[model samples]
Target: MKAAVWYGKHDVRIENKEEPVVQPGKIKIKVAWTGICGSDLHAYHGAPGVIQEGTPHPITGEMAPLTLGHEFSGIVHEIGEGVSEFAVGDRVTVEPMIKCGKCEPCKKGYSNLCDYFGFVGLQSNGGFADYVVVDDYMVHKLPDKVTLEEGALMEPAAVAFHAVKSSQMKVGSKVAVFGVGPIGLLTILCAKAAGASQIIAVDVSKERLQKAREIGATTVINGMEENAVQRILAETGGVDVAFEAAGAEVTVNNAIASIAKKGQVVIESIIPHPIKVDILQITAKEANLTATLGYCGVYKEVIAMVASGQLDVKSIITNKIVLDDLIENGFNLLTSDKSQAKIIVSPQ
Candidate 1:
């Protein structure tokens, strides 16, 4: 089996390795397609401690030289002992979240908030390889209406659905999404599905903003061209809910400032560093500031939406590359081109 292994920061190499075998309570999947995530880009950019190297991950206990592809879909090649929900040749998408079921949060049905939660691709051998073995609990069967490409997007779409569902967004609520990347674009779709009346998408890239509008954003703003906050305020008074998905200091501030009084701001992106915020402004408005981590229990809903043609996950895909070209054609293309939305990696 060929796998892209991350040995260190900015050091991902494809090497042939023995295929993973099915284990008890787990299933072996022949990976069909995988998407390179922003977190993978973070690992490639010399982010310290993201890819466990010297110290092992507390939950998986897996360190560096780990395979890297979490947003993926595949065919169930082999079923492990005790697994009965799925059999051989079932097409499925994985949730890819590893959690301690005994944790207080997990006990409360909020496994995403578990104390020992770790993402599969980051902490274990992920779907980047030709074959992956994950707990049967993580598998979600894809309907006939959903293709393997759309199935590959289930993980990220789940994140978007969770973000919108977790927010205090009501019907006809005005929404703004700062950042029109895959996650941000998907967030727009989720907001629309949630019955948001107006969605304002803010991004620096014109191409992404256009794509956002095509999906469901009622309006688009190029932060690089105009004052996004002022423009948004002038157009809609102010959004009822704002989402910061750009994971940058400027966009975070813009998201906070673009909402009306008593509005809520959902921080969706992983802003790596701390920056000064206008606490007085947020306090004066009596607005709410909330943060969202990974998703929990939303895979079925997203898959249903996609299968019903309510959510077009396929439209977000811009490129497809083979596993051998993942580094150059997938990751490098994403890093260099801001216009690219989603790039799928075919592992077969």
Candidate 2:
């Protein structure tokens, strides 16, 4: 089996390794397609705290130098003992989240907030390989209409779906997404499917903003060219809900300022460093500011939406490459190209 192993910063090597085998309560999947995620890019740049280091991850009991992909879809090649919901040759996409079921948040059905939360690619050997084994609980069967390529996007789509579902936005409410990156673009799609009346997409990239318009965004604002917050306020009297997905201080503040009174702001990106925020802006609006983690309890719904053509997730896929070219054609291309959105890799 060939796998992309994350040894350290700027150090990902495609090495041939033994294939993973199924164990009790596990499933061996023949990986079809895997998407290179923003988190993977973060790890590639030596961003700390994402890939478990030094001490092992509590769930997977593994660390860096592990395989590097989580947003993947595959065919179940084998099912371990005690697994009955799926059998051989089932088409599936994995949730990839590893949580401690005994934690308070997990006990309350908020496993995304579990005390010992982790992910498959970051914590253990993942789908950046020909075959990978995962806990059977993480598998979700793909619908007949969903292709393997679209299935590879379910993980990120779930994140967007969870963010919109967790927000205070109601049907017919106006919404703004600050950042039209892959996740941000997907957020727009999910917000539209959730019945948002007007969707505003903000980004510095003209190409991404254009793509946002083609998707479901009713208005696109280039933050570099115009004042995003002011424009959003002037046009729609402020959106009913705002999402911060740029992972930058300016966008975060803009998202906060672009919301109407009592409107909600959801931070969907992993802003690595702490930055100063205008407390008065939030105070004046009486708005709620919240953040979403990976995802929980939304994979099935996201899959159904894509399968029914309610959400055209495939529109965001800008490129596709084989596993051998993941680093140059996939990772590096995404890092250097602003127009590239989601890049899916075929490991086999």
Candidate 3:
């Protein structure tokens, strides 16, 4: 099998490795498409704590130099003992989260907040290969209408959907998303599907803002050219919910400032460093401020939405590459190209 292994910072190598064998309660998938995620980019830049190192992940018991891809979809090639729900040739996408079921959060059905929270690509050998084995619990069968390419996006779409579900958004509610990256674009789509009346997207990139408009954003604001917070406040009289997905201090503060009285703000970006925030802005609005981690129990709903044509996720996919070109055509291209979004990799 050929896999992209992350040995260290700026060091991902496509190497030949032995294929994994299925085990009890596991399923071996012939990987069809794997999407390179922002977390993978963080790891590529040597961001600490993204990938388990030294002592090993508490759940997967594996560390760096492991395969690096979490957003993926595939066909079941083999099913392990004790797994009866799926058989060979089932189309599926993985939730990819690793959690300790005994933890309080897990016990309360919030395993995304479990004490030992980790992810497949970050904590174990993942789908950046020809074949990968995962716990059967991670698999979600794709609807016949959802193509394998769209199935590859279910993981990130789940994240966006979970963020909307976590917000206080309602039918006809006004919403603003700060940062129109892949996740942010999906957030706009999810907010629209959730019945948001006016969807505003903010970003520094004109290209990304255009992409946002193409998807579902009712309005687009280029933060670099205008005062985003002031513009949003003037137009919507303060949105019902504001999402900070840029992972920047300025955007976070703007999101906090752009909400209505008692409005909610959700942070969807995985910011690597702490940034100072204007606490008074949130205090004055009497707003709710929360953040979302990896999703929990939303894969089925996301898949159904895409399958039913409620979400045109495929519209966001800008490029596709083979595993051999993942580093240059996928990772490097994503880093250097602001217009590129949702690049999928095929390892098969």
Candidate 4:
């Protein structure tokens, strides 16, 4: 099997590795497609500090120098003992978050916050290769209506859905979404489906904001062109919910400043740097500040949303590359001013 293995900071190599086999309580997926994620970009560039040599994975206890690529979907090549919901030849997408079910958060049905949560690509050998071994609990069958490409998007889409749910966005509320990256665009669609009446998709990229509008964003704000704060207030009278999807301090502050008084600000972005914010302004507005970790408890719901033809994943997937080209194509996205929406990695 050929895989793009994580070596260290800025060090990913394409090499042949032994194929993963199905184990008890696990399933083997013949990975059809995987997507390069923002976290992968961070790891690729030497952030996160999770892939360093000899560091133990919090959940799987697997160390670094592992294969990394998560967001994927594929056909079930084989099933393990006790796995009954799916079988060979079944197409499915995986929930990357593998939880320690005995943990307190897991007991509370908030497993996304589990103390020992493990994301596939980061914690173990993920879907970067042609075959990936995942616990049965993490895999779910894709409906016949959905394509393999859309199935690959389920993980990221779940992240967007989780961000929207964390804010507890209300029906007909006005939303201002900052950062129209792939996740940001998906967040807009999720907010719309959750009943946000007016959505302001903000980005420095015109190409991205244009994609956002096509995915159901009612208004688009190019931060490079217009003052986002002035435009939000001007357009919506006031925004009820503000979602920060771009992982930058400036966009986060933009989200904070654009909302209505007492508005809810959902922090979905993982800002690379420590950002100093005006606590006084947030205090003065009496707004609710909420932070979303990755996703949990919503893969099936999001799959349903996509399957129903309600949420469009097609417009967001911008590029597709094969396993041999993963390093070049994937790294290009990290370094370049990507006009692309999302890039998919095909293993087989």
Candidate 5:
């Protein structure tokens, strides 16, 4: 099997590696398409929180050197003994959250908060290779109407779905989303489907703002050019909910400031650096400040939703690269100024 292995900072080698060995109670997938996530790019260059240098995963116990990719869909080529929920040739995408099913969080339906939670790519060898193994519970069979490309995207889509759901969005509610990246774009789509009457998308990129409108953004604000807070307030009178998807402190603040009285602020982005946030906004507006980690049990629901035509996630795919072209394509991602969306990888 040919696999792209990360050896050092900014170094990835495509070479033949032994096929993964099958074991009981595990599921093996024949990789079809793997979406390149932001964390992968960060990890490739040895960025923090993506992976710890020379440190082993607490759950899988694999060290910093890892096969990188988590958002993927594939065919179940083989199933381990005692696995009967799926069989050969079942089209599916995985949850990728490796958790102890017996944990308190898992039993309480908060497996994303599991004490020993380990993400597929972050903690173990992921779908960057031809074959990857996971527990059977992590795999979800896709509906016949969904394509492999869309199936691979279920991972991120589920995250977006969970963000809105966790925010407790209501029909005809006003939503202001900060950032227009892939996750932000998808959140816009979900917000509309959830019946948000006014969807305000804010970003620094004009191009991304345009894409946001195409997807479902009722209005857009270029924070670099206009005051996002003023722009949002003018449009919706006052936003009923605010979604912070940019992960930057300024954007986080903007999302908080844009909310109306008694609204909710949903923090969907991963803020790694320490940053200041005003508690007065929450107190003054009586707003609920909530955050969601990774998603749990939303993969299949998103797949079916996309298949049923309620959501169209394909508008955000800006680049598609094969395993052989990862380095060249990855370089473009590193240097490009435009906010190009997702880059899907065909590992085969």
Candidate 6:
């Protein structure tokens, strides 16, 4: 099996490794298509969280030299003993999260909030290879209408769906999404599908903003060209909900300032640095601030959405590369190309 292994910062090598085998209660999947996620970029740049270096991950108990890919779809190649829910050749996508089922949060149906929550690619061997093994519980069978390429996007779509579902967004309400990256663009589609009347997408990237419009955004704001917060306020008296998906301090500030009084702001990005917020402004507006982590249980819903043609997730794909070209064609291209939205890697 060939796998892309992350040894350190800016160091990813495609090396040959033994194919993973099916274990009892687990399934071996022949990886079809995988997406290069933002978290993968973070690890490539040596940002800690997913790629455990010195200390072992509490859950997977793995460290660096990790295989880096989670947003993927595959075919059921082999079933482990005691696993009868799926048969070989079933097309499926996985819920990459690994949570401690014994935790109180897990018991309360908030497994994503579990104390030792981690992801497959981040914490253990993942799908950036010819084959990967996972517990049968994490697999979700894709509908016949959804192709493997589209199923590769189910992870990120579920992320966007969960972000909107966690926010206090009412039907016909106005909303603004700062940073029209892949997740931000998907958020736009999710908001529209959820009946939002006015969707404003803010981003410095003109290409992404255009995609946002094509997807569902009623308005697009180029933050580099205009004051996003002022423009949003002057036009609509502030949106009902604002989503910060850029993971930048400026966008977070703008998301907080772009909402109306008593509005809600949902934080969807991972900001590593400590930043200041306008506490007085928040206090005066009487608004709410909520933060969402990885998705809880949105895979089935997103699969249904794709099956019904409600979300054209495949349109967001900008590039596809073979496993051999993951570094040069996939990672490097995504980091340098602003127009590139989502890139899928085929480990054939």
Residue 116 CA error for candidate 6 (Å)?
A: 0.8
For each candidate, the alpha-carbon lDDT, in order, equals: 0.91, 0.93, 0.93, 0.85, 0.84, 0.91
Clashing pairs in 4: none
Off by over 4 Å in 2: none
The TM-score values for the models, in the order shown, are 0.98, 0.99, 0.99, 0.96, 0.96, 0.98
**Reference-based TM-score, model 1:** 0.98
lDDT (Cα, tens digit) per residue for candidate 6, span 25-49: 8999999999999999888988866
**Candidate 4 Cα lDDT to native:** 0.85
lDDT of 3 by residue, 169-226 (tens): 9999999999988999999999989999999999999899999999999999998899
How many clashes does the backbone of model 5 have?
0
Q: What is the lDDT of residue 275 in candidate 6?
A: 88
Residue 251 of model 3, lDDT score = 90
- Candidate 1 vs candidate 2, lDDT winner: 2
lDDT of 5 by residue, 174-224 (tens): 999998888899999889989999999999899899999999998999988
User: Candidate 6: worst 10 consecutive residues by lDDT?
Assistant: 46-55
lDDT value, residue 154 of candidate 6: 92
* Over 4 Å off, model 1: none
Clashes of each: 0, 0, 0, 0, 0, 0
